[model samples]
Target: MSELETLNWQDWDSVLVVVAHPDDAEYGLSAAVKEWTDAGIEVSYLLLTHGEAGIQGLDSAETGPLRAAEQQTACDIVGVNNLTILDHPDSMLVYNLELRKEVAREIRIRKPNAVVLSNFEVEAYGGLNQADHRVAGLAGIDGTRDAANPWAQRELLDEGLQPWITSLIIITGHDEPTHTMDLNPESVAAGVASLEAHKRYLEALPHHPKPVEFIPEVLRTENGFAKTFRVFGV
Candidate 1:
């Protein structure tokens, strides 16, 4: 693995962010995303689920829409206007044929040169990272390749969705990463604002005496300084 020198940032035209739930990109890669967008790159976000399973006291049926709405506001804050949700059920996002096809279709349509997502291999806070996170990450990577291969999924071609292959894949949350992009001050602010937008979701967590503490830990932790990701193929 090699960490390429800081990118030109001005050359990228389009980027696609794929994650398991809402706010995943914002917390994981919004900083780098800001720089890309500022450089005139079009950033599209594809979340596999609406994160309805989040929340400690509210019903998922109710919380899902709320979280999704929050995600919209968060993306807007960070200058990302293109967002899509697969609306898959939370906690049970299966890595099956249907999921892969849908993800592939989106990739084909977006045709982004770069992709960003959370790490699938890292264990969660208690050795239990969200199952959907891992499922989505694996599927997103596979979907990128599947999207570009005509023989991979005939049904997609029949549906008029062409295949697409992204040039780069960046995975956040990995302790040892190949690339670290130093975020600018504007992006750091955007990251904080983005996480704050997830009001309902943050309140749902069991940790912290109050919901206010979530922001500091998230934006100021060891993983907070520079956005790190594994760069495949170099």
Candidate 2:
């Protein structure tokens, strides 16, 4: 329980958020995203999967497009206009070289100073983390490095994307966070709205109660609603 450092969001001009599924960012990061976007920081989302296998009864064909739309709505609510959903299979993400390359390509193209990622650890304060989440987080870290190395992913260079080094990486939903971002009341409300945008998806989860209040409730702090992250530098 070391004192968490405060992240100066204004220091970075652009950030690219990489996550496993549709609602992943809305869980906690959306509050901070609201704060960042309000300050005119450019933000983009790179979702590895559409969370097609999230709903129990629905098949991939139905759930994929539905989840994608939900994610877009959620991002829009949080003021994120750039959202990209990759064709990676939901619930079957792997932290392999190919995945790293795909993520690196996005990093190169975006050239963000900071990258936000989901927790890669096996467990968080909430509970055991999912396989897809872990894979995506791990791949994001590797991709951050690969994006800076010209020889690492040569195909991206051939595609006219130049190598770019990211300055910071922030891992949300960490068990022990090193940095925190305090959110204003408006940011908290926006985060709630962002999660609520996933109406159909939230309805499908039997365990989720009061979906709109979920994020604000879980991430509330004494100062204000806050999001925490484990910071890494490149």
Candidate 3:
């Protein structure tokens, strides 16, 4: 394990967050995102799915649009510049060349200097991780590299989407994070608000802890609020 250090974003101009579901960003990386956007770095969210399978009792037809709307609302709270939702099946993401290409397309289009992603480990927070998250995270990693290699996705060149090399990839929800970011009260509040935006989804959970409660509890550090992440440098 590497020694934990304060997250470094001194040179980052823009960031792209990739996730499998609607509230994944909120649970995993929202506070850090709040801090980033507050510092004037443009942030964009790329969701592989509309999170149709997130609500237990809700049908996909209803859950899809509902979650999408909530995700956009959440994005607005953090000053995210843009949001793009793809048609990948919820709870069924596959880590294949196709998935990598799709993610690469977004990376190329957005040309973000840094990318934030969900944890891809087989286990996280001391429990088994979901398959979709594992797939999405792996895809985010590969796609970042793919976006930098023109020959990896030749079609992107035809679409006028130039190759982009993301300098950093930040993975949230790891048990042992390599980096940490201090969060001010305002930033933490913004993150809470963003999580609360998913009213329907959160309400549908069996025993969903209120964002205000769990967020602060999880983020509380010795001095103040903070969020940790595992980082990969590209």
C-alpha lDDT score of every prediction, in listed order: 0.76, 0.88, 0.88
User: TM-scores for all candidates?
Assistant: 0.87, 0.96, 0.96
Prediction RMSDs, each to the true structure: 3.2, 1.2, 1.3
The 10-residue segment of model 3 with minimum total lDDT is 27-36
Tens-digit per-residue lDDT, 5-90, candidate 2: 98977877889999999999987789899999999988999999989998878888999999999899989888898999998999
Model 3 per-residue lDDT tens digits across residues 1-234: 776898888678899999998889998377788888888898999999999988898899999999999999999998987899989999888889988998899988888988899888887867998999899999999999999997998988999999999989998888878998788988888899999999998888758788888898899988988899888899
State the displacement of the C-alpha of residue 32, model 1, in Å, after optimal TM-score superposition.
1.7
Error of 3 at 54 (Å): 1.4
Better of 1 and 2 by TM-score: 2
Per-residue error at 36 for model 1, in Å? 1.4
**Candidate 3 — which residues are off by over 4 angstroms?**
none
The best-first sequence of candidates by lDDT reads: 3, 2, 1
User: Per-residue alpha-carbon lDDT of model 1 for 57-76, expressed as tens digits?
Assistant: 78888988898899999888
Q: Deviation in angstroms for 198 in model 2? A: 1.0
Which residue pairs clash within candidate 1? 147-163, 147-164
